[model samples]
Target: MSAGRVAVAALFVVALVLFAAVEIASRREGSRVPSLGDVCGVVMRYRVGPLPVGRIAMFGFWWWLGWHFLAR
Candidate 1:
């Protein structure tokens, strides 16, 4: 496979593993993942003031930009 495809596949696997780890940690801690309300609250707060939404939007935006520029 080409380098770019390989990189994407590896990143995909890494993301899956990270997500699984988050889920496991959440279960062990007896704390649930962020709810829609939480995310909405974050967005609302962000609009009112600058706050780290945990880089969620930035990650998605950069991922989109990368795919737009790099993926054929």
Candidate 2:
């Protein structure tokens, strides 16, 4: 594998470990850590017509980023 691919894989592994660590630490602390969904729900509590502007912006960014990387 190329160095760049190896680096990406390494970072992916690190992210997985970091996510697991966060879950374990939060459970041990006996504190309720709000998840991404919870935060988004709180942020978009306002009615922005039929669809929320935040959701449109977030999905647009995700779509653009995925296309930019995968279309290469």
Candidate 3:
């Protein structure tokens, strides 16, 4: 694979592992929520193979929130 694809795959695997680990840790610890960056990073990583669904969903969610609320 190309360097970019390898990097993306590595990132995706890391993100997925981190996301799962963090989520499990949070549940065990009780009452702490993961940060926005963590979630978005996971989504971006997951989309690496799929080509843009994750990215689009992540950005679209932000856009809707900004448009409906923050932009006001």
User: Among these predicted structures, which one has the highest TM-score?
Assistant: 2
Judging by lDDT against the true structure, name the best candidate: 3
TM for every model, in the order presented, reads 0.43, 0.53, 0.42
TM-score of candidate 2 on Cα atoms, chains taken together: 0.53
Q: Say which prediction, candidate 2 or candidate 3, comes out ahead on lDDT.
A: 3
Pairs in steric clash, model 2: none
Q: What is the C-alpha lDDT profile of model 2 across 36-55, one tens digit per residue?
A: 55666776664588767777
Per-residue alpha-carbon lDDT of candidate 3 for residues 1-72, written as tens digits (9 for 90 to 100): 899989988998999899787777756555477665676788877655658778888789889979976776
Clashing pairs in 1: none
| Backbone-clash count (model 2) | 0
Give Cα distance to truth, residue 50, candidate 2, Å: 8.8
What's the C-alpha lDDT at position 38 in model 1? 60
Candidate 1 or 2, higher lDDT? 2
lDDT of 1 at 41: 61
Per-candidate local distance difference test: 0.70, 0.75, 0.78
CA shift of 46, model 3, Å: 1.9
Tell me the spans in candidate 1 whose CA falls farther than 4 Å from its real position: 29-72
- List the candidate 3 regions with Cα displacement exceeding 4 Å: 1-35, 48-50
* Total backbone collisions, model 3: 0
Lowest-lDDT window of 10 residues in candidate 2? 22-31
